[model samples]
Target chain A: MPQLKAKSLEMRTPQVTKTAVLVIGGAEDKVHGREILRTFFGRAGASNGYITIIPSASREPAIIGGRYTRIFEEMGAKKVEILDIRERDQCESAETKASLEACSGVFLTGGDQLRLCGVLADTPAMEIIRQRVRAGQLTLAGTSAGAAVMGHHMIAGGGSGETPKRSLVDMATGLGFIPEVIVDQHFHNRNRMGRLISAIAAHPDRLGIGIDEDTCAMFERDGWLQAMGKGSVTIVDPTEVTHTNEPHVGASEPLTVHNLRLHILSHGDRFHLYQRTVLPAVHRISS
Target chain B: MPQLKAKSLEMRTPQVTKTAVLVIGGAEDKVHGREILRTFFGRAGASNGYITIIPSASREPAIIGGRYTRIFEEMGAKKVEILDIRERDQCESAETKASLEACSGVFLTGGDQLRLCGVLADTPAMEIIRQRVRAGQLTLAGTSAGAAVMGHHMIAGGGSGETPKRSLVDMATGLGFIPEVIVDQHFHNRNRMGRLISAIAAHPDRLGIGIDEDTCAMFERDGWLQAMGKGSVTIVDPTEVTHTNEPHVGASEPLTVHNLRLHILSHGDRFHLYQRTVLPAVHRISS
Candidate 1:
């Protein structure tokens, strides 16, 4: 019966629009960071929302999917399910497409950012997510490596705690969930500042956001970023920077820059992403 | 006799190597930024230096060339001549090619940055400058637009006084004298922080350098950038930046970033380009 319905919908384009992106830094304790999850659940319409957990970023997708399945069910999501597929080809199957088309929320588990982007970027599954997000039918959420892959320019790998220099970080294409910013997860715990700096300096026009190990930066449809969890979110603004030596120095040379403005926002801090303003926590999108 | 000899050397491969680039910010005032030019002259063997003035970046190349010719002569150069051609084709001329071959130093006058790169970026004259500089035979000095085109990425145009936003500035390829930095001139006087930031955000890996109206940032072959002039040189180092919104935001959206390390160096300040350290003013390369 479900197969017959899935085939019928093949002729119909999926109408899905996303409302927000819940990007969690790595090490988000599912227990302590449950409110962040609950916020997604609540925004997803409490017990009535249709949720699909994508654990493809993990090596053990089945195990991770089951874990989230129990968590969401326990959290009062009545129609919770998991998409248990490893191959990119499964996204094209009528069953998977049909299931995803009805989903009101999608959660991605953390593992390898590249793995996630490799499977989903430019794929049918990815297109549905984008279409749904643009149509405002779903809220997307991801953690750790999942979060890292949200931006178009993903930070693949780099060293930490060193001085900013040339070729210190590796960058690659990411799943275009959050298109304007470069997102780095597990930033504080991994001491990834040096690499993050390299990423931003390499493309200073993009906003760089480093989410701490336990934090989440929830980007709403209206372009507001609200912080959640115990850790901080570091914002690197190179817009007002006076100079950078990255383009002048040698490949292995140390880089010098002048006048880069910075901002560090903690949980409860609210930022207007479109207007680029720092609003008080309580002043944010309160229902 | 010197002209004939120069013409002969034109056919010979100009074995030129430059050891350093003396890039001056615009409105040099000859008096305030005179020490920078004096440093170049002194480093090029003072009165014994063979100098060629290329005023191709200027609209009035002949007048600009004549002015620098007299300045270099008055400054006690042994030989100072001009390559007064405006078209790119003239770079193939025997006289122009030979004159540049015998030059131990080249002084590029300021006018239009695009003009400078347009005429010199891939021209034979440019190749000679790079070859000579690489071989340590010539020291090139450029002011204003001449200075702006020293980097691999040039700040073509942008707005001022606004917070950093997407597409706020335009960038083009530069003269490639220095391959790692983005140079912006008349920084403080013209209030160019916004455009500089946009340029840096666009290419974060390339260090952004905004030279003040009277400042000079001398990039030595030893990987040290020494600051010179009345005003400060702003360096926007994105290596340590934690986040940037440039990749996530829309065309009209404002950009926000976090933790971009900045260094504002004034006269006498010396920074190690490879190590990215601020050295004591007195602790510099004492020739």
Candidate 2:
């Protein structure tokens, strides 16, 4: 019999995490010379990179696409493509997949998380994107609603509160790239902690990550999460929480949870998911 | 064939977590009306409670144990006892186990978490304690080192830093009441966040909870962990992190992680570990 204190429980951790993902909580300050965008470009390779922008999450894809095209191009990306697919069938087209596979990095602009997941989830285009990322050929970046959809358990919509309560947050399925977490955008300005907590309460054992405006939590394939931008990244973890009155209450009832673990991260904060710890990062050297 | 997004892995979650653990992170102001102690008493049945204090974690067990004995008695506990097991062999004595089994609550004092776990882990006394807790007969409370030993993954020793780095924190097996987390004491005042982060990084999937002076993160049988203190409880979660350079570093090499989630909880904050969220608690109604 194993000792009661033993912790190796045969966890089925992810096998290959060779891709990098940027989950940027939206309304990033572009007037500040787009610091976050520039960083993404650098990660994708500043000079010899092929960058693709997917505007599917936006209502006006062409406009959003056009705006990012200029930003990335100006950042010295060798080739910036506005990846487009007008219809559902376009997602299955070999031409689109091939084109996506050729990119060094992909960016999804802000709009609606549901809209983005609705268009791209389980599609041939998404398959190619995942393949490229896992194969170490591409870096995937998303902002705002695009960022929200990065996790497997996405927050479709929710109301906000200073203190956490149940039923305040709503949830929906997403692309599942970051399945163990639920990402929220425009965190502090909207005061989304309450809703984020509710979502985490519903999906027990998963993490709730809220990114502030102009802030980004970047994920590398090895499951290392780092914070960047002017604001902070708020993380809500209910894994060690000992009590929650959620199951006993009605839909509109307030939540009561005890022992929830949380973390607040800013620039130069590094976290390893596999090791389950935080490491402080030194300032990035400007290339 | 399994779909790519399948989250249903056969996770071997710990088989035992039936007891209520109140892991207090130390320096709790007992002089100021003993608010946390009062709350603890209320959980243990208040006026009709049988409370036991184990000061083995302290270098001066007698003094530390006496202090708590007086507090619990003053709180109107029906009976207060100082459990004595002088010899290591006494741990196997049926008399010791029986005496401990009678108490409604057990409070462990602060000093060295290692010594506490060393003396009690796998002992017959501990076996009985677990049995009683599993049967919903006892509440286990601990402070400082006592608090640290509440989790299965305990931080044995570590150096503090403002930024996280490799080899800063050491790990050891604990008593295992709260297995999913790594608890740290004297958080902010001592600048222990750096070490706490390193500890969390060393053990992935488990949460890192740093409790500050005069703070208590109360856990009940319902899996709720609540903060009742002047300082905050900092939570570090790397479960959603995608990458970290920890595996590649030496003792002093700065660590790099991406997308780490964090939360800072002060007074009135209640966290649910399973739900992975924090809920704010209103002031308690005196019993």
Candidate 3:
């Protein structure tokens, strides 16, 4: 009989490839243009990594896609390619595949999340994107719409901020680059509190991150997220909130939210993503 | 300085209203049809209570709006009023105002959440609904789509499961009958886990209730919710989840969900919506 490897032994081996993620708030292009770009290049390891930009996100306008290409080039990136995925066919193009395969860093610019998802769903590019991330060859970064698409579920904006109704926004399948978290940009500035709150109340098990403009949260390989840039990131963890008396009542009933922990993190704050808790001071980056 | 008046204290006193929320999971006009009809009558009460049904909700055969009116009459409701809200003028008709003012309960039948919000937004009927709820004179009950419209924020339906990127579902403002919670019905049957999870993840502080078919969780005045009817209710409390590293990586990033407390409550299980923990058995309702 052949000797069998124990499952525990197999689990002990470290997975190759180091992955880093950068989430820039919607207005990052205007505020921390150079700094955000520098962070991406530095994280990607200037000499070893190639960069690919998905500009289809420009449909939302708030996301400045081409800006990253120019910035990355200026930062001494010899090979910078932009994949203009306007139609579904382009997402499967040979050029798109080549660029994605060669790149160590994939950047998604801000725009319309729905548009981006529509262009990339179930395509060869999507599979490649997932494979590269898993292989640790790619570090995915997004700003605004780009960042929103990084989540498995992306928010498609709709309705007003007045009520916490399900009709206030639209949700679509995102790139599935990150599972179980919903991403919202320009969170505090736009008073997206109602929408974000509704989102969490809808799915209590998932986590939400509302990155303020000019701020970024970097998710390292080990499920750790470190807050970087100006302003603060709001971590809404509803895992403990209880006692919801809602949609069944016809009249507006007072909703009681209990045991919600809100963490406001500025630059240098470190959080363990799976643990959903703030890390100790030792883990935080010195500004 | 103004003297603190006794009347001020009285004004701020918490007024307790006898409100009953009837949640119908499946076949509002067929299965448990009599019970649903009786639900409307119960809301009307013996005194000056009126019942108004919005027909616009039943444009689709599955909605069964007119059936509610017939059931209300069969259940001995003295006054059963049908308000056609499709016409812009009808939203502010004298009949609509009188029906709202004279009635103790307003029945919102099953239909589309988007349609309900669209018809009710900025309307006199909408204002009356809000006033009645605040006055504690209304017991709002909904089935299916009607139930979806009870919360301040409503879910219009979206994607196949929860992956974090936006699903195809849309969220809009609802009647605001219930604040702070997002309600989803036929949760398990329709596999709405992803949508509900997405909603809660976006708003970590709000509570999410996924009521399975034939099951209902009623939020009482004391800030407690009692599960009733057949099947079970899934309460998702994300407050204790440890790590939520989102917006930092690609869609393939493994989600780490730690310490999320999920409660599966059957009939007569009383959950405290505020505390987010299971209350002792002594506080539970005697079924």
Candidate 4:
């Protein structure tokens, strides 16, 4: 059923996504500037924000949940709740749905992506969160594995430090938070270019966005993506791919792809996802 | 179209797979013993065998193709032809079709699984190969990347040192020579248990077969798989899996799966593919 829904979503003519999603690569600055987290806190209405932290993905849910709760509380958020979901059935509880409905912002913590999806996929709590985000009634942010689950075609796991080969990247169904794109977190630091390229080679229709550690690729409702934090976001656009030896080569062998468009964006740079173009950064006036 | 075909193949009630397929892990003892290759040669009718070596997966197609051709010829094969397919269009040619139709056995060499697929997938030559294979007219044996591409759900590449996380395995569409199982070559030698397990977690319906170096998982028309060579064939059966936190965890986090039945088969051991049971090896009286 999700596959059918995804197909229909893909078939629909391009429209600006109403949801604002902040996708952070792994190891985001928690102690330093906290520019990314601070940006997310402000976007969620700051003091008026009612935040929900979903730490099911982490092995130490309480610790991870408490960590983020304190961070948001220190930032002066109005209210924050830790949704400790241990089992799939817990997601259907009325209390869980209610918490999601009342929240202005939701944060997904880092852990195993498969575990996160195992508990939340197809659950009513996740459904409500998705509906609210789509309606532009909520702001959502996720880090590390949280960021990896935002696409339809997820790069679940794969090898790095190798040539881009069909065997280098592992893919699984994703949460479809941003269906038009495929994302990889902790990109450059892990030397994950080969895997990402391998992923894009398999799915040329989707835009490949690789977020480096400590970086965030923030998606706005207006369809422009803004880069924030210290690192950069690398985009691999395969629209012009004339030929690819992806299917021709064997595992561990190098892949050959022609004419892939690449773009690297740092803080303040913006990219239009649908248009597949980088927009010139305009000077902002501080009020 | 291939997806539809694959789905239809999957939907069919499990019947005894008539095609005899030899799936070898990488680095099978090519120089000595050569038990695996010799078995394939014998299955193809030994001295009367008309063989076609497909080295399209290798970068040096000519050299790899010649190596197999000589090996087969030295074993007293009736004839051997190296099908040097460099382009997709070549698969549609009459010469290509004729050569495939004429061969009693087909040997796909190792290089890059993606490259092998790019040239052969959905092509007329490949279709003939499949038709013959299904009709039990041809014996097919592939090693390394060749072995990887025999299944419908192919493990293209992935990381090994890490735990079995959803992010550790990369999968792609394979040639479907044996769609019922997913194969990974050079298994324990490369510490690929994690990737293979991750692959099975994603596709619970398919049996996960990990062939070790110098090993082979031979599928007979009778539907029983016999292990050959020095190393063992590890089978990860997910049919009894009651629970998995694969979808619940985030990327890089260890996955939790319960009730997986595992069997490691060595030389002469046989396993029933569909029934999900190990068959006792019968003593053979030498002629």
Candidate 5:
């Protein structure tokens, strides 16, 4: 019944001013990704905010590796660092922690959510990143695999459309920067409804955010999120569903969800999580 | 904050009023699947209702084809029939239409969502089913594949994990019984958040309902949905998110989502789509 107000694109100008988190969807930092970064941080007075790229994902070497650095440099980033968490040691290195601490904004490049989670689980870098985000000292932004780990529960993937067997797929602990939510990237482009729904069904209390291939849903410090770009994001909440998943069978069976609430947000829309409704603010983009 | 109220439970009474629709998830006749059916329909008076099972879904010969009929017979049903739509003509047969029209409720057995949609698309039987549901003359219930078709859009299967390039399995026309909503079966059991999110992201206006394998979420005449099962259902709505999902050069693109509302519903939970909030009257079923 309530409409979310939109903020001017101009408000995003110099996109780096007081941003507490910078979430980049997979494929961001390409053509539009850089432009998006400029819009957000360019006006912040800094040529570029500290950007840390995590190349631990599968597609990292192909996408965010070599030429990507030059592009970010050209985009006006003052400093760009890449954290290659391919090895266990790299994930725990002192340098990784220092880079995480020194940077104002950490960017996770596209790759594998499972890989990222596996490398960073219980690691010092993860701890530092989490600490910085909670302390409001640094902004955390991730694309693709990076984005998937923002939530406490990361979706590893699984079987066919008919069977939602948890063991069929894998799940790992996420960065937990944003508690109470599960993040999915390349949403519509990949037809990931089955997986996202499976994740929500597994954890009814957690919210599921599915980001489209060319879209980004960013959450601000005040706990409001806005959608920007071409596609939309899917938000799933199962707080009001009645179900009997067991049917008096196995003790540890998959959950069954009944009545649930869902909302879809496109560019410029704002949603308040705590209030659980759309805000009244209007959003606009400025050059 | 309102809670869902249960008008009646079939478990409490062996013989009761038959519903308009009976949706059975995949494997409904299978050992595990039967329990899911018994948990939901067993309590709803599966035997007493005019039941029709779509046997085209079963991988094996519909050996258990008459299982529902027998169950409902014991539950005090006047009659039970099985419809096999395997033949091309059977899908459009006059007998199908007459049987459907004559019945008080229709049951969709679980198998493959794609298969079910393919068999019923544009057929007279499909139209009759849709019309009956809209007219409230028939109670429509589906398990697994059957449930998938309940929504306007259906999720086919695809990729394993969080890869930006994973194919969007497939989406075809469903029964359209539930307008503006996409249904995913075996939701949390298989960690389907990725797929469900993708589906919701593709269609922002539609709400996604991911029912757990053994669980079922029922929508009453008043448009309120209640969950009943051992597991939970995941609802994803992306009305408020901000991000850029544009592709980066040769790299996998990134997606960003923000500020979406999510609610987790278990047994006894209620959600009013019109109000877009959780009702206080609904509460979780304690094991």
Candidate 6:
């Protein structure tokens, strides 16, 4: 009876979004194979796609915006526009909202997360993007600082290569594009396990996703996250944690935690977000 | 008129405790000159003192507890007792409470802070020690992990050598011996400036005090903290901070903070805790 109800619900929602969010860690290869970018290009509908680039996070928005525009255009995007919304007021403009409305995909470039948030947060353009993404009308992707802002609870900056503790990372609000997890980019390359673990300890309800340099954790509308690129994606699940000293202990004390689940996913590996289960890659049976 | 009132109060209280809290960083000279320990011994009333050493933080309590006992005995302390309580139940014992009550001075040795808190926090002996220290009836000194637990907000453990952000260190509730500040031991020797700054950013209300190796920051009853020994004490005061991204940014995000007051005090230099002022060392009049 439950299966029948779920099947009916799924049938009713025929327009379910299949496009995924490409969350690339910093330092992704752009010149060579460009596998991640190529994947994004195909997912965004190639020649039929109208891609918009938001480079507000960079110090030189034009340079970064032009870079992505060329990359997407070279990959056969029909229309590529650089929104370059430098000011917060620009985010409220009709032209900005129209650009986003027409965009099949949006790419947020890397630079300073605080700058990105300063320009995009709480504006009409951002609201429209959020709504469209939720409605399966747009595919969104960000890299480096861009990837860091995908989660509702963002890791702005903090130190790495230490024991996992409350004082190991700094946190702030993000764009809320993906609200269920806290994302940390340039993971293992920068030794950010301690930072991610500390973040998870602070917000146990949210999963901690640490993406290594050149890696991507693509989240699909069906709630399955797939790992891509050369490096791996680290998932820290705090749901099974039996005990944590976070509440009783003060701000900077070493933590005592028990039963945290961790998973390292490489290319082609898939994980169901809600179910908290991993799906190993299926090997091709060559006859 | 205010001065007259203060004088009157002072006249009424002739037995004001002259003892100070000797907060030593890790690796104080145990064999060499023993300058810091000797200072502590004299302030603890030398030959007339009944000093109690708490070595619960150490894995081998008896070894560490005996080491300090011998040091004090060598320094001519007539009475020295090792109250090495390993269990929480032992902290509640009558003997533990009696030892703390009879002692004129209490010394906490270096070890694992988590273990120390597990054994001592909320126990009968801990409560007695807190009350006595507050009432100025007992002199208190701690080193390394001992010094780490002096504040209401204690830094348990975290990384170093990074930008000052919210996640650079871990904090937990300390013994609250000195409630107004957050203490970090083995400061400059370990390149912990960033760690201390992060701690201050998280807790602007509490001053971040970083004590270097073989150094001591002694807090007197009059609210003056004096630096002693070879290295300097870095005091980070967050009261002047005009802006901080801590409230808005997510966990691990790089923080943007402005106008934090910092002071580095060497041997003989003093800082007024409540006033948030620094007093330079007084040169000797050799005439």
Cα RMSD to the true fold for all candidates: 18.3, 16.5, 16.7, 18.2, 9.7, 15.3
Ranking by lDDT: 4, 6, 1, 2, 3, 5
lDDT of 1 at B108: 86
DockQ scores of the candidates: 0.10, 0.04, 0.02, 0.01, 0.13, 0.02
Span of 10 residues, lowest total lDDT, candidate 1 chain B: B278-287
Candidate 4 residue-wise lDDT, B1-287, digit = tens: 99999989888855432347899987877788677888888877678789999999999999889988888898899999999999999999989999998888999999999999989999999999999988899999999999999999998889864435678888899999889899999876676766787899888899999887787888887788887776667777788665555576576654544445655565666778887667533452110
Q: What tens-digit string does per-residue lDDT give for candidate 3 at B1-287?
A: 24478778878995443666655554433445344445446545723445777655557533455676666666666677777687556779888888888777777766676777787867898888777766667766777777787777777787532233233245677666666677878765565644665566555666667776655666655677776554446666777655444334334322223344555455566677677666422343421
lDDT of 3: 0.65
- Residue range with the least summed lDDT across 10 consecutive positions in model 6 chain B: B278-287
What is the per-residue lDDT of model 6 for residues A1-287, given as tens digits with 9 covering 90 to 100?
99999999988874433467889988888888888887777677667888998998999998888888888888888999999888999988889988998888899999999899988998899999899888888888999999999999999998753334567789999998999989999876676766786788889899988887777888888898887876667777888765555756566544444445655565666778898877654541110
TM-score of chain A of each: 0.89, 0.89, 0.84, 0.90, 0.81, 0.91
Q: Of 1 and 5, which scores higher on DockQ? A: 5
Q: What is the lDDT of residue A259 in candidate 3?
A: 45
**Tens digit of per-residue lDDT, candidate 4, span A115-204:** 888888888998998888888988899899899989989888997644356777889888888888899998766657557877988898
- Model 3 misplaced stretches (Cα beyond 4 Å): A1-17, A29-33, A60-65, A246-257, A280-287, B1-287
Error (Å) of candidate 6 at residue B25 is: 18
Please give the distance, in angstroms, between residue A279's alpha carbon in candidate 2 and its true position after superposition.
1.5
Every model's TM-score: 0.51, 0.51, 0.49, 0.49, 0.57, 0.51
> What TM-score does candidate 4 get on C-alpha atoms?
0.49
True contacts kept of 2: 0.05
Q: Write the per-residue lDDT of candidate 1 for residues A1-287, one digit (tens) a residue.
A: 99989888975854333367889887666775376777777666567778899988899998888888888898888698888667889889887888788888889899888888877888788889888876778888889988998888999887642345556678999987878889988765565655676678777787788887667898888888887765667676567655566666564544555555556565566677656666534443321
Better of 2 and 5 by DockQ: 5
Location of the lowest summed lDDT over 10 successive residues in candidate 4 chain B: B278-287
Q: How much is the lDDT of residue A159 in candidate 3?
A: 32
lDDT of each residue in A79-130, candidate 2, tens digit only: 9998765567888887778779788889989988888888888998998887
Candidate 1 residue lDDT tens string, B165-209: 556688899988788899988775566755676677778888888
Q: Which stretches of candidate 1 lie over 4 Å from their true place?
A: A1-287, B1-19, B31-33, B283-287
